[model samples]
Target: MSLQFIKRIFTSGVFLISANVMLSVTSAHAAVNIQQWQTSVGSEVYFVENHDLPILDISVNFPAGSARDTADKSGLASITRYLMTLGAAGMTDEVIANKFADIGAVLGGSFDTDRAALSLRTLSSERERLQALGLFANILQKPDFPESVLAREKARIISGLEESSTQPESISNKAFMSALYGKHPYSLDESGEIDTVAKIKKEDLQAFYQQFYSAKGAVIAIIGDLTREQAQQVAELVSVGLPTTPAPAPIASVPAKNQAKEQRIAHPASQSHILLGHTGIKRNDPDLFPLYVGNYILGGGGFVSRLTEEVREKRGLVYSVYSYFMPMAEAGPFQIGLQTKKDQAEAALALVHETLEKFLNNGVTEAELKAAKSNIIGGFPMRIDSNKKILDYLNVIGFYKLPLNYLDEYNKKVENVTAAQIKDAFNRRLKHDHFVTVIVGDPKAE
Candidate 1:
């Protein structure tokens, strides 16, 4: 199952009671009206007021993801973000955890290639909301980055990196990113390498935090039981004490690949893990709609995709094969990943290439186009079924500077994509001959 689905299942029980209460106030099809503004401290705010449930969800984002790290300090951004919640404003990690539990609140974070985010979920009642918002603001404005916690977290992360280094999937992923991105910041693993992470000190984290986690660069997304005035107050409180430095420079451009290259690493595993592709579009690329729809037909539609039909069912060369375009602030990888017996690796790879070539040459049929549109547009509501989900969309919209109507017009964009548009997008955005390939477990290894 997908990680998102798994997360939904895991967290469903925690919010079951609140979700039922919300049903009486609003239907699943309620419209989302987002309000956008900026705080006096220069933080941008996106608000969606929904009193359906007595719950509030807030996410604060900054341009402090791994892409902001220097080569020598590859994992600095992630570790800094983690340390913020562990201890802040004179509170120990245990104390912070206990306080949140007492208030029935949840604290979480997301770190990726482009941004770092801290999220909070809590009851919207006056007492509970005030307590939760106060603690959240402290974590954002006054992270202590204790030395003892830093050492422990460093050890834990190093242990994980060591273990993952020995796994074929990890091996292939790191190699694949390095091959595709080269010297770009995106190539650095979010979890810093052992050598680099070990050298990181408490001072480094404090400096990094001050530099990238400045108020001027903050994007605060708030959804749930709050009025426009209240949201403004909350934004001001969260951003009040943050550093007032200017926003950091934009990330460097992702370099283009000019030739196809393959790297094969020998391993003792019985199956070969393969990854191949080149840099694709950014989040705001004009071809986003057409490319998204076309990919559904090419390899993203599960068993119904052209890749699965050609490589898995017809020839039985592999159990599963999939491709996706991960659009980021900059061009992200357009990756196709698969696994098969070592003996069948070459055959699976060949069939994948053949299928991609045919799909590009012929484009998608009208029937395939209709089905893709139907599947994508039909499932749009589920994307914003709850306050928490809408909070996520607000974060994306504010951080990426996308049109406020992005979620509103999502289905229309998908419906308007034609076969010709899909064909042209695919042809212009992807060059099969320039793909970079990484394989773990040498197919010829015996």
Candidate 2:
């Protein structure tokens, strides 16, 4: 079937499900009227007023991720964020949880290398909205980092760390990142070593929060049943209590040049977990579109992808093999990961390396490019079929300073990516001899 025919069927009501999906796509891409502004306290606010739902979703992001942790205090940032919701002002953790539940509101948050975020979803009614916002602001600005709670969380994290050390997947991932980033802060796992986590005192969490959780570092994305005026007010409430200071400068990019190295750990696992790659592109890299489309065709598109076809289907060496580039503030790792029987690990690795080299030299075919773009474009609506998903995109765009029309332009950008562009971008960014490899399990000796 032609693209136009699919579009017509989806855009029209011949099928209710397809029509509804298309309507969601239209609303997300075309009606995503993001209004942006800066609060007096220096927080950047991105707002979208959607009255179709009687719910409100607000996410407040800060530049306080694990990357900001000092080497000695590696997990402080994550612990600080986790503790923020536990105890604030005079309220206990139970009190905070009960307060949100009493009013039918939900509290959520995340921690990663480059960012820390806290989110809220609540009914848009005045009583619930005001109460929830009040609770959120308190958690953001008035976190107590209670000493008893600190000890308990530290014990919990250390226990988890001790368990993770024996897991093959976790061991390989940690070692792979260390090899890929060397001394870079990005190498540090969000969950720091047991020794470091055990040493983190309550004072450390308080100090870290005070230093990095400033108004200027805030990226507030608010969406739902609220007027622009109300959104402005909500943004102010979220950050007004924060200290007014500019955020720290962006982290430096990972070095593009590095010596290739291999790390093999002796583990008694039945299968070997292998991971390989090097520093990839940053969020604002010029070749973002080409690389995005190219990676999909190479290994990210599942069964149709080249890596899957060669490593899994043709040889039956493994159940799955995949590759992806994690676009971040600095150059993130371009990882190709897989698992295979311990005896077949060497063969699997050789095939993977050959597949990558061949694709880099020859690039994808026209048919592959066309199918990749079609699949990516067709799947766009599923990405933003809900308020939470749209909120996530909005939050990222605001946090990373991405263009407001990123969602609308995404499909067009994929459609325009050419095979030549993919080859050129891939060749320039990924060097065959400069990647780091980590394998955990018994394999043939070199």
Candidate 3:
């Protein structure tokens, strides 16, 4: 059958099904309507059409993540992404800024270990959409890689790197990644090191672009104020006249962390920075919902988290303490981090370790489980309520090839996760013994 015929059948018909029967399932968990189609140029789009608002939030994603950077030239991919909008086609960064400002839209870009994305939020009207879309297209397909702007961006990045090297938190986090991943790409910093940033060139950027930004590796997720027909057009419109090569780069492999380390750095800051973690789960893992819910009790829930409660409110060790797992295409970090008065740092770190070990051993308390579930489920809708939020979710879905209804099932998955399930997942997955401990403010007293 033709591709056109498949799409026609995909969106229109209601086919009957028995409980055991499944036909090319989209998302079994989410009951919400999620429309998906591949554009003629091969950009895939996921849509949740809500016409109630006159705004559109669209996100385009690619596998151009930091992991793809050259091992010898770490941070190249990241600098490439950051420099994308500085100049594209014939437009300077100033001109690009003016273009978006003129249209009353926002163009945003971000990347992590495994994916890079550019997002646009605009009035869904025709004129605004055209302007916004034009900028996005230009950046994707025609980034000029102008030498002058590249120089300026490098200087700016180098300055930030210099500043960060002095920062207690930055120093501590960098140490933790080095400890966690060893020689793996996950251990590399996205912003790169001072020496690497200084050595980057425009041709290097262009070569990297040519190698990575191809149709085969690209996924476009468009939502708001577009029909199926228009979305198909958008795929073509956005990805047209691009690099013609098939995807050639290998997807990065993040090795499982086998051990952990501890280190300390001296700084003049009033508080000591601490980071403890090891390798984390992947982005599309089945265990994501369970881990996410479980993490809230660990530290992600702010004042309600055991970390914050033990370190901040209960004992006044630090002003703030938190934990999060990055979850990307590759396994990322599951980190518990905080800062405390230099004098209190050693005691706080010991308590945090004990607390984590306790949680890992016994799981969250019953009250903690209920509170985490209530907060996560209750606050879920606010995440996807606006077009911008929808686009953000769509970006992840599109990039990761997630089920079209990932958001639809989000609440249900969280709802169905049992406390026992959470505990089991933690014990099965989180290996606290291999933690990479980094303290960047003072040495623990001898």
The clash count of every prediction, one per candidate, is 0, 0, 0
Compared with the true structure, all predictions reach lDDT values of 0.88, 0.86, 0.77
Candidate 2: segments with Cα more than 4 A from true spot: 1-29, 444-446
User: What TM value does model 2 have?
Assistant: 0.93
lDDT of 3 by residue, 1-446 (tens): 22343333334445222333212324334434667655545555676666777877777777778888766777788877778878887888998899899989998977987777777778877768766777777888888888888888889888999999988778877888888887887778888888988898988999888877776667777777766555555566566645766764656677766676888888878878888887888888888888899898889999999899888998999988999988877787898888888989889999998888888888777788778889998998889667767777777877777877677777778888878888888887877777788888875522
TM-score of every candidate relative to the true structure: 0.93, 0.93, 0.89
How many residue-pair clashes does candidate 1 contain?
0
Please give, for residues 1-446, the per-residue lDDT of candidate 2 as tens digits. 22343234323444222232211211234747777777767788888888999999999999888889877888999999999999997899999999999999999998899999999999998778888888888898899899999999999999999999999899999999988887889999998888899899888887788778999889998899998767766776778788665687788667766589998888878889999998898887889999999999988999999999999998999867999999888998899999999889999999999999999999999999999999999999999888899899988898888888888888888898999999999999999899899999855532
Better of 2 and 3 by TM-score: 2
On residues 1-446, what C-alpha lDDT tens digit does candidate 1 reach at each position?
Answer: 12343234333544222332211221123367888777777788888888889888999999999999989998999999999999998999999999999999999989898999999999988778778878888889899999999999999999999999999999999999999999999999999899999999999999999999999999999998888767766777788689989998999988878888899999999889999998999999999999999999999999989999999999998878999999999999999999898899998999999999998899999999999999998888999998878988998898999988788778889999999998899999999999999989975644
Q: Which structure among the candidates has the greatest lDDT?
A: 1
- For model 2 the local lDDT of residue 232 reads 66
